[model samples]
Target: MSVSLNGVGLTHANGQVALSGIDLQVSSGERVAIIGPSGAGKTSLLRLLASNLRPTAGQVSLLEQQPWQLSARQRQHLRARIGLIHQAPPLPPRQRVVTAVLAGKLGQWSLVKSLLNLLHPVDMSGAAAALARLDLADKLFERCDQLSGGQLQRVGIARVLYQAPELILADEPVSAMDPVLAGHTLSVLNEEASRRGMTLLASLHAVDLALTHFPRVIGVREGRIVFDQPPATISPAQLDALYANEQLQVLPAPESTTQASVQIPRC
Candidate 1:
């Protein structure tokens, strides 16, 4: 099993409940997409899986180990096996793209090697290859601040690809890209995950993108799972209920780009 959550709950220090009773399971090499409204606890779920957040209740298992149960040092080692891609990568503004990409392995690298590589990248070829896969090879030496949002997102993905972790968790990874590029990047992610037999779980705002790329779809709403089904099995009525917003009627996840989008409220 790649992930297992049993009645898991998370309440922040501010006392805002982000998730409650989130019971989920994913097999090894399974690729799943999480779709939901903006505040539906999608990010919280991913953070919980990434070991960035501790659950307030219930049990959480990642890669067969309980993250919170382990010692801090042991948990750090466990974290090295998981690749986390954020919506906006937390990279230094003045850092070069190569340095940023190479940092992906710092978690697994020895202290001396990590420090030396920070000063002078030891494996420029590997970083370049990863960037090349995302069409960012030319920007390798450029500072991160010089890149566009979409470019930065790709850089984050490149770092994960280079890291080669057993599991991948991405949160709204392509929100800044154009439709076509977003589609392409997702295709790349799916391809890489499949090729490497890496388990992938991504929270996506683009419902069409989720339907197009992922075979399994999980619908989250108001910190709970509304439905978990294949794209073809999901109904328009179910979607309408999941994203019911009182303010304005809006589009539900379309079956395909060619199909007319379903009408619902804002997610």
Candidate 2:
């Protein structure tokens, strides 16, 4: 199994219960999408899988090893095999795209080599090739701040692709892109995972995109797994119940505008 979460639960320091009773198992090369309303614990679940947040209850097994049981150095080594694409990538604003992408392998490189590479990118061609996969090859030398939001998201993904991890976790990766670009970006991610037999799990608010791109869909609501089924098997009624909010019904719908808005999880 690429990931296994058994009866997993997390409680924040401030007493916020982010997740509870999350039992999930994903095999190698499986592409899964997590969807639900905002504040429904989607991000928390992804963070749990990425080992960024430890569950206060239950066990988390990644790549057949219990993460919490591992030593700090061992955990660091394990993290090198996982790739996380963030919603807002934490790239340095003034850093060049090539340097940013190459930093993906810093965990695997020697400290001396990593510091040297920071001064001058060692694998320019590799970074460029990764960027080319996302149609951002032209921005290789541009500062990260120069790119648009969608472009920065792509750069984050390219960095992960360059890392070539065994498991890929993404959170709202395409939220900044247009519908067409979002579709294309997701296709690239799915294709890469399929080609390399890597495990992929992503949390998305766009219901249509999730259904279209991923074969298996996991619905999370109120910090629990409501349903885990194939895309075709997920019914509209289930989605409605997952995102239902009484407050929205009391309000009137806004007038249609020419400018398109990203698909929000409907209630």
Candidate 3:
């Protein structure tokens, strides 16, 4: 299993419950999409799987190992085998794109090599190749600040592709792009995962995109799994129920004014 969550629950330090009873499992090379309304614990769940947060209750197993049970050093080693694509990839504004992409392998490289690469990108071709896959090869030498939002998001994905981890987790990976670009980016990501035989789990807000791209979709609401099934099995009624918003208000149309007709005196 690439990921397994058994009765998982998380409570923040400020005493806020983010998730509870999240029982999910993904086998190797499986592509799964997690969809839910905003603030519905989607990011929290991804964080848990990434080993960024420890579950207050229950277990989280990633890459066949229980992350919380491992030692700090062991967990760090484990992290090298996993790639996480953040929505706003925390790349340094002034940093060159090549350096950012090469940083993906910092965990696996020697300290000396890492330091040298930082001073001068030692693998420019490798970085360019990865970016090329995402159609950003021309931006290889550009400063991260020069790129647009969607371009930056693609750069983040390229970094992860360079990392080539066993498992990939993305949180709103294509949220910044146009519909066509978003679809293309997702196809690239899915293809990469398939080629590498790596497991992929992404949290998306686009229900139609999720249903179209992923074979299996997991719907989350209010910190719980509402449904987990193939796209074909997910009903529109279920989606309506899942996204029902009680706080939504419908505004009435503006009242029309009836103008009085004036009689023409010269007729």
Per residue, candidate 3 scores C-alpha lDDT tens digits across 1-267 of 999999999999999999999899899999999987778899999989889999999988999999888999999999999999999999999999999999999999999999999889989999999999999999999999999999999999999999999999999999899879998999999999999998999999776668778888898999999999987667656666677763322222112211222111110
Q: How accurate locally is residue 32 in candidate 1, as Cα lDDT from 0 to 100?
A: 99
Please, what are the lDDT tens digits per residue for candidate 2 over residues 145-264?
999999999999999999999999999999999989999999999999999998999999777788779989899998999999987666656766887872222122112211222233
lDDT of 1 by residue, 59-140 (tens): 9999999999899999999999999999999999999999999999999899999999988998999999999888899999
- How high is the CA lDDT of each candidate model? 0.90, 0.89, 0.87
Clashing pairs in 1: 250-264
| Candidate topping TM-score | 1
Compute the lDDT of residue 104 as modeled in candidate 1. 94
lDDT of 3: 0.87
Residue 193 lDDT in model 2? 90
Location of the lowest summed lDDT over 10 successive residues in candidate 2 = 249-258
- Candidate 1's C-alpha runs over 4 A off are 246-260, 263-267
Clashing pairs in 3: none
- How far in Å is the alpha carbon of 176 misplaced in model 3? 0.9
Question: Whose TM-score is higher: candidate 1's or candidate 2's?
Answer: 1
How high is each candidate's TM-score? 0.94, 0.92, 0.91
Which 10-residue window of candidate 3 scores lowest in summed lDDT? 258-267
